[model samples]
Target: MSETTDPDLDDSVRIADPSIDTDVIDRIESALEEGALADGPEVRAFESEFGAYCRTDHAVATSNGTTALHAALEALDVEDGDAVITTPFSFVASANAIRLAGATPVFADIDLETYTLDPADVERVLAERDDVVGLLPVHLYGLAADVSALCELADEHDLFVLEDACQAHGAAVRGDRVGGFGDAACFSFYPTKNMTTGEGGIVTTDREDVAERVASYVNHGRAENGTGDYDHVRLGHNYRMTALAAAIGRSQLERLPEFNERRRENAAYYDDRLADLPLETPTEPDGYRHVYHQYTIRTDDRDALADGLAARNVDAAIYYETPIHRQSAYETVSTAAAELPRAQRAAETVLSVPVHPALSERDRRVVVEEICDYFHNQ
Candidate 1:
């Protein structure tokens, strides 16, 4: 889509990248020395900071993003036979979490441009289904979904909204952050996400009941901390975030905006250069902000392009080579038989390039040039 590479540049340029700061290392070293690595002060500090960032009243740190989502579903009291509508184009965790929480996941197609769940499609699914709890639209590739319309549908259906915001830590739709739009939001702090805690996740909620439910759900259903050591309120899992992970998360959260900005800057460079290409690049939906987590693009000849990039020693990835609904696990429950054309198209044509924050101007140029060259040869 774009080409601005220097002839002398190397093959290390990528589509997305993660930003790392020495300050994070320093924070980790200090935490380890002070034994502040598990559910410690640093962990508490990160939960507070993350909650504040998401404009929520509470944030519960969990072992992983999947647990964060599970906690939300638990908090909402989702049970067997309850249905949750979600896009099939997202990470399997989105639907998997629903299935794990004893809920049925209804598949929905995504908006072609934003690659997020389509509200129209969501409504159609809801209209034709029953016992639907709510929508769990993912902010795919750091782009926000059509939350306003989805929220309207939820209001009309009297359903709960639990967002799978793991890959969209700082993304916004309609001028509102992903976490702020839903009843509860889940985020992953994996190393590759916009931010990292080494490994952890957080759940945000405005409702005290939901917050308390998730808090208890994460810690073996303990009703009180020091009141009764053996008291168990409800069934729970050991999905707690370790202190070390929280320590790193605290540092990373503070630097999130800067990291997101770097991603945006790199994406801006590609947007300017790839305007003339035959490939279809990502687009920010109306009134939404894209954080460019993967900087994915779609080309009719994705396999050829990927092979070409590989031949040049550049790294390009095919994200979700198979749509989740098409997977064997979902086949029995899936009402549609690989019927999502856009999802299937994206699965075949989409390619993830490095878009991490560690990229330099020279690196961006090389990546763009390699992609442009592949298309030109085709």
Candidate 2:
């Protein structure tokens, strides 16, 4: 049997390294001292800073990435029976958000090299179905999706664009940041991301209506112009980011550029070091800046490689071993236009080695050496 199917194989090296230093604690303390620990100044400030970073007019903070996606879909008016075109090879949250917003998620294949939603497949799906109300594309593995093409499709089809930039904090396409390209883009501030807020997310957009709607959706549908009173103006949920999380998020956000640069340097090193190996390294197409959330490689012997790396204490992860359409929860609502062969192939063979900013040079060498040894032994 191929190593890709091995059940016991696992990545030994952990991928993320989120540092919470004294500065974060100081901010948290300030929030506590001011008695504004919940959805107060810190979250507001984080939103503004993050908005500026993304070059968006406004940003709405949420409790987590999934909530941000749900809120964005809600703002786009995704409702029951409405379909959203999205890549099948992504974290389940991308599709779950569509379902949570009362929409059906139609699966599209990916551009294997970029591992993003394929524009041709998306256009085909949109042309065939009139119920597709939005294009939900994921910037998978810190590489920006083809939002430029997706936007064109959206304009032609009269559909909204919601970018799932949960893993693409510093990524950009054609010199524009990923978050501001779509109608609304969702970001994850989980510890595993380029930056961390312990647990949080944000929605960035240029549209005031979308910004206002998402802001309202996350805070229990309360009107924007209201006191700290509980007034249920519309159906909403308590998806507000905590002041504590926001405080930490601010510190991490401030350090994001530096962190992303380190990640890039590490990825470059891997590119040179692993060049001779019998595997396909990550790709960064022209006009796109990849943040290297996980430096994934494709190989037929993925499971064996991962197992070998794990045996040597090197953690390699398979970002999405199962495509969204194949998951049981989505079996009923999800429909693929045709066979998503590229996405299927990716699910079976892709493996992510550590490319976090925290990795030392020795750690990088160990990762490459283990994989090299694995293939050598085989």
Candidate 3:
């Protein structure tokens, strides 16, 4: 947690680090040594290992996180003209994937504490709308959403639950992994994520049917599970993860626990140091293990805080400065019946500081000192 053990933190404090090392290099070399570099042994091994880690029966790899979600929604039978309920506080891709699946994203406000979909708000919306066929709750900033409540709502309304676990690779709730909660959960392996495959995604599920559907849809809609080439059963996309990326992913996946633990340590440090400050620190609800992808803090003067941190060489970032409904791309199809005050307030007030594993003790102290100086001196 400090520079004594992590010497590289002094170099620079970034929001995230890929943590690539000799192991990743060796895996890439091994993948190249083999004659197969396409969706071959490495991809299969990654899927199997990742699925096992998440306690899911099947894990389907894709080109990226967005495709994973799009495929998940489609595999769950979210048809055209259907509406999917989701929070407006997440990354744009969360809502965009619903659109890619030919469904309208119904925006709901988020809970102030978790920055996730408000279950009560969701239930209120469901009671009023009949077209909502699914619930797509994002585990934003690496915290598990209220999947238990969302799952209950889904069961009560016969709706599908597809967790957006892109930022929450190893996060859990009540001792269960976030990826294992919903019908199918999507994970991102982008370089900035908790784990990286250069650029990759996966769909984890216990349902054999969902696994089979996502597998086929991601591979040109051909019949999967050893089906011969040119046997196209349905229209699909070529969203396959390369063997090289898969190899990197497997190596990263192996180190995910360590990475998440280091992130937690960093987050705890920030929480303790910044407790008395006017800004609100991140929260880990009861029984939820939050893998801190971004240690986001909320303050009314977020711009000033970000500016001050940057001026002092501390990298601070704002995730989603604009909500999805406010974004121009979603203005056409996105619907909002009730006021999304929490989401809007969060967009205006939140700022993420460096909490990545690579941060050094010196870097941590610099961030803490700078943030305190900004508030106390003013």
Residue pairs that clash (backbone atoms under 3 angstroms), model 3: 9-360
- By TM-score, the better pick of 2 and 3 is 3
> Which regions of candidate 1 fall more than 4 Å away from where they truly are?
1-11, 14-17, 33-36, 224-228, 336-338
Q: Would you list the rank order by TM-score, best first?
A: 3, 2, 1
Backbone clashes, candidate 3: 1
On lDDT, the stronger of 2 and 3 is: 3
Candidate that scores best on lDDT: 3
lDDT of 2: 0.88
RMSD of 1: 3.8
The lDDT values for all models are: 0.82, 0.88, 0.89
- Poorest 10 consecutive residues of model 1 by lDDT? 1-10
Model 2, total clashes: 4
Give the per-residue lDDT of model 3 (tens digit) for 1-378: 112224444445666656786777778889999857768888999999999999999999998999999988888888887999998889899999998888999988899889999999999889889899999999999999999999999999999899999999999998899888889999999888998888999999999999999999988898986434788888888888899999999888888999999999999999999999998999999999999998999999999889998887677888889888888886676474447899999999999998888877788999999999999999
lDDT of 2 by residue, 168-253 (tens): 99899888888998889999998889998889999999999999989888988999854298876889888999999998888888
Evaluation by lDDT, superior candidate among 1 and 3: 3
Better of 1 and 2 by TM-score: 2
What TM-scores do the predictions have? Answer: 0.93, 0.95, 0.96
After the best TM-score superposition of candidate 1, give how far the Cα of residue 290 lies from its true spot, in angstroms.
Answer: 0.8
